[model samples]
Target: MDLTEQPTFAFDVFSKACPSRGTLEHVTGRWGALTLGALYEGSFRFNELRRRVDGVSEKMLSQTLHALERDGLVHREAQPTNPPRVDYELTPLGREVAERLLSLIHFVQGHMDGILEARERYDTARGGR
Candidate 1:
């Protein structure tokens, strides 16, 4: 397989055709979304964030925080101490995005009952009952 021999897809990740794809990926990554949502509450230490976001491993949390920091969406501070506590919080830009994310979360929570009911109905219907 040589270069330029593969089929081309609709999206040109090389050319950066779409603006939202990268942002969407960053915001909805395995740990990115959870990180943003958690930071919405307030600044939290690494352990606190890990505990708050269930199922997230320490490495993933660290990677997510680093990515968010590089993107300027998160601020990381290290305290001067023997253990050297580290905390993360959203920047102004990050806060704006977090607000939007909160709204989306609220919308989902509000409709969860209806969604569950719909799912149950769908399952029953598909079961041929």
Candidate 2:
């Protein structure tokens, strides 16, 4: 933890002032979700992550990884080499949340057909174009 950053021992996400809201947003948002899911497979460097997550621009992926790293969900390691190398992987806390996210994704995938059919029915009834 940085000396400039204060510690929050207790937090309430329902409250607008809670820091957890920002953390939750980082973990659950589009790029965050995909990044964590990809890292769950194995460690990856910057370009590899850019490839694994389709359509995520360099800036967006970097921002997402930065947020996750700040939140203690991802570990960034810098290695000493001629050119230097950095790799990212899930911390223990990160692995816990990644597993949960993967389970939620699987659950949604299992019901996708049903969800699509329901959406079609609703659209038809509502005269959607």
Candidate 3:
């Protein structure tokens, strides 16, 4: 009966349930990372996002935008004009995540040689050299 001795869970503010696994999947998603990176440059419309992230299908880009918006990491604006212009930007929270992701990209680019060497070693070990 020593409830005070138990540790509190930050994720279980409402109850004992932890954060949903979908959260992780959303953040680490293939297009999600790239979307954040693209948005970091500035606000862009849907087509612009699609253009910046080459090879991303329209459906996938839409899904990624929805997920980011749901997570409060992205801001979506729609104008009721003749053509109806919509733009997407990063929220402050998103900027934090984007900066971290940018740093990761820089790190990977800087260490690409080491990564290539490691891949070569693995390929040789697998007799695929």
Candidate 4:
């Protein structure tokens, strides 16, 4: 099909029905953010990932990995061990996204103190929740 023949759709994240919005949510959700950030170090097995991500349940990790795998960001490989060793790694696309996430994380880290202070001031002004 020629370029002209290809149909195009508008992508507006503000729209309630945008697919990219859902993808954005999935990638930046607490579990997705932590999982991808941890994988930036290297591939890890299921338990290893669980330990690295901190506070992620087995079900959440499994679901996150599967979602990322579906999005072509994460790679899942299984070794033929007696118990079957499954390793998870970031694809090049995933690395690109992970790098962006790392930048966001660093920004949050640098701003956390101020953020907490703001929260405190806001809470105090509101008579403490």
Candidate 5:
């Protein structure tokens, strides 16, 4: 291989040392998932994203955005304006990921009633702990 050539890596998320694990965590984490799902709708300003994600704190949203941006799953655009507008949107990769996540989200939502019943049964069996 040429000295200037970069080595290709085959990443496996199951490996403890794999970098993909970090990206997976970022994409699947509570705030990260919520943030990505919100961005899937369309581009949103920082405050708008915060509002869309609902329960996420400003600090958490900022951190989640930073992680997603670092992972190449989100794009942050800052405009030169009086108020300094900043917008967040999903990259193509981000959109692809969001599409998959949305499928899971919909599946869980559709089965929520059954899930609740299962949970109730489990709780009752465990003495309502």
Candidate 6:
């Protein structure tokens, strides 16, 4: 290894202590996923994002944005104004992650009928428990 060369780390999400696990959680959690998907459409102000991500409370959205921002997946911009304005958008890395997540989202949505059917079958077999 060259003295001045940076060391590279192999991050494995399956490892309990791996930092990537935390980031993966942040990217895939309910609020995190919704927040990222909404931002993927475009930049949005706080309230706008709250509305777009429907069901996410103001507190959850705020926390999700903070986590994503810390993970380098979200960019937060604040402007000085009469009432103060802030916008959230995906960083380049975030866009890439969102693209992959959207693929999975679409797949799940497309298969929802089958998924529901499977659930119905499972419930029926279990006597609706």
- For all candidates in order, the CA lDDT equals 0.87, 0.94, 0.88, 0.92, 0.94, 0.93
RMSD per model, one decimal: 8.5, 7.2, 5.9, 5.9, 7.1, 6.3
Which candidate, 3 or 4, would have the higher TM-score against the true structure?
Answer: 4
TM-score of each: 0.78, 0.88, 0.84, 0.88, 0.92, 0.91
**Cα lDDT for residue 66, candidate 1:** 89
For model 2, how does the per-residue alpha-carbon lDDT over 1-129 read when each residue is reduced to its tens digit?
Answer: 799876766887878999999999999999999899999999999999999999999999999999999999999998998698999999999999999999998899999999999999999999985
lDDT of 1 at 89: 96
How well is each residue in 11-84 modelled by candidate 1, as lDDT tens digits?
A: 65456667557766777785898899999899999999999999999998998888888888999999999989
Q: List the residue pairs that clash in candidate 1.
A: none
* Window of ten residues with lowest summed lDDT in model 6: 6-15
Model 4 TM-score?
0.88
Q: What overall lDDT, based on C-alpha atoms, would model 4 receive against the true structure?
A: 0.92
Model 6's C-alpha root-mean-square deviation from the true structure amounts to 6.3
Tens digits of per-residue lDDT, candidate 6, 32-74, equal: 9888988999999999999999899989998999999999999
Question: Residue-wise lDDT of candidate 5 within 1-129, one digit each (tens)?
Answer: 898876666886777999999999999999998889989999999999998999899999999999999999999999999989999999999999999998988999999999999999999999997
Candidate 4 local Cα displacement, residue 62, angstroms: 0.7
User: Which ten residues in a row are the worst by lDDT in model 5?
Assistant: 5-14
State in Å the error of residue 6, model 3. 16
For candidate 4, write residues 39-103 as lDDT tens digits: 99999999999999999999999999999998888999999999899999999999999999999
- Candidate 1 residues lying further than 4 Å off, grouped into runs, are 1-20
What is the clash tally of candidate 6?
Answer: 0
